[model samples]
Target: MPSHERFRTRREKMLGQLRELFLAEGFASFSIGDLAERFRCSRSTLYAVAPSKEQIVVATVRSYFKTGAERIEARVAASADPAQQLAIYLESVASELQPASATFFADLADFGPANEVYQENTQYAARRVQDLVTQGVKVGVLRPVHASFVGAAVAEVMGSIQRGAIQEATGLDSAQAYRHLADLVMTSLADPKKPAHERRAT
Candidate 1:
């Protein structure tokens, strides 16, 4: 491989290990030297991916969520029904977030760059939900609630969840909180007269 490809390959390999560590222990609990030791590599190797510990954390967070977005998109595309597509999207997100601890999310919320990735992801999801709502309403599966209002509400709830407010109030971790959020959105949008299978949870 070329030199740059070799470097990219090595960085990705190290980041895979780092992602697992962050999920297991939370990013706030580790330092550069700590990560180096955990990976059984020199501090220089860690620095190869990022100039400092903070940047490494940001990079790891980006990588985790980027992969998550791909998975969610794939699952959403697999379904033909709007409600099923929305449910699959939300469930995929919940699964991706199942490993996040309170501390991990707390750190993510406080960090600017890392938080932006999360915010973008949430916005994209909200847009998707809005589109699904529009589709379902047209198809008579969802009630004629304002799609924009519901989309914005879901985004607000997601913002609260990212900031730990939801977890603080409900004692739900990120994954559980997202599941409840999905349920709320689906229940609110589902047309009562629709078939039971259409309203069933994913």
Candidate 2:
């Protein structure tokens, strides 16, 4: 391979490693030098990923969430049932977030650019949930509850989760909170006239 190709591959690998490190331990405390040392790479090599530590954090965080969203959507797409899609969506989100430590969430909230990425992702998630709920209602699988109202309520709860308010009030991390949200949403959408076992099968 050419030198540039090798460098590109190495940089991509470094970004993946850095993302895992940040997810496990948070990015707020890692200086460029510290990251370089930890990765056993030169400062210039680290600069290949981003121009600065802050930018690196932003890039990594953005990539993490972006990849996670794609995976979640892929899972949702595989399931044909709208009701199942709603449950799968939220559960997939929880799974994607399971690796992130509390410190990572704290750092994400503290940092402006990284926090923006997180907030944007959360907003998209809220909208996706709303779409799923709408689909469920259209298919006559869910109760005829107002989709717009459900969307707004989900948006508020998601925003609170992003801001750490949910954690403060419920003692649940983002992943666990999302699981509970899945349960709550599914319960609310369940058709009352359906037998309990029938509802569970959906």
Candidate 3:
């Protein structure tokens, strides 16, 4: 049984440790020496996988968005209506990211992600929006808006929902904002005149 233990590569172990540190403290401006202390490994070991702190930060943010996209995808699949699917996807994404403090967001306020990992995750999310919008347009659920425009609009709303909702709440917290976001998305995307097949084709 000793030799039958589950297998994991050194790279996987390093990634896991990196994830663990992220969960415990969130994003920090840590040097290789700092990560070395956290992982109890040589600085060379940390640098072996992530050569720079920027790489590590980008990797962590990529992980965040990838996890968020997966959550939204699940929500979309579970919903019966295209409208509802778009709403659920938006609300769920906001719900997932609401815990991330605004400090990191403020720091990277204008910094567009340059890493391919983050870009790929973003494209995946965008494709989901495209599907939702195209379905809405096909079904007459939403008005005849360009799918690209609608997708971009939904993406913006999803990012802005936390701020929008929080400002409206007295003591309601973020849950109310997410709920409001879902409702608004449904209102915007639902096309009652079109059939499921036509929309699905989209």
lDDT of each: 0.83, 0.89, 0.59
Best by TM-score: 2
- Every model's TM-score: 0.90, 0.93, 0.61
Q: What's model 3's lDDT at 190?
A: 52
lDDT of 3: 0.59
| Most lDDT-accurate candidate | 2
Worst 10 residues of 3 by lDDT: 1-10
Alpha-carbon deviation at 49 in model 1, angstroms: 1.9
* Pairs with steric clashes in candidate 3: 140-191, 141-190, 141-191
Worst 10 residues of 1 by lDDT: 193-202
Tens digit per residue, CA lDDT, model 1, 1-202 = 9999999999999888888888777787788878877888999889987999888988888898888889888888887888777777777788999987777777778778888988888888788888888887878777888888888888889888887888889899889988888887777777788776768545
Model 2 TM-score (2 dp) = 0.93
lDDT of 2 by residue, 83-157 (tens): 888888988998999999999999999999999999899889889989988998999989988898898899999
Rate residue 109 of model 2 by lDDT.
90
lDDT of 3 by residue, 23-85 (tens): 445555667788888778887666655667777666666656666677767767886677667
RMSD of each: 1.8, 1.9, 6.3
What TM-score number comes out for model 1?
0.90
Candidate 2's displacement at residue 84, Å, is 0.4
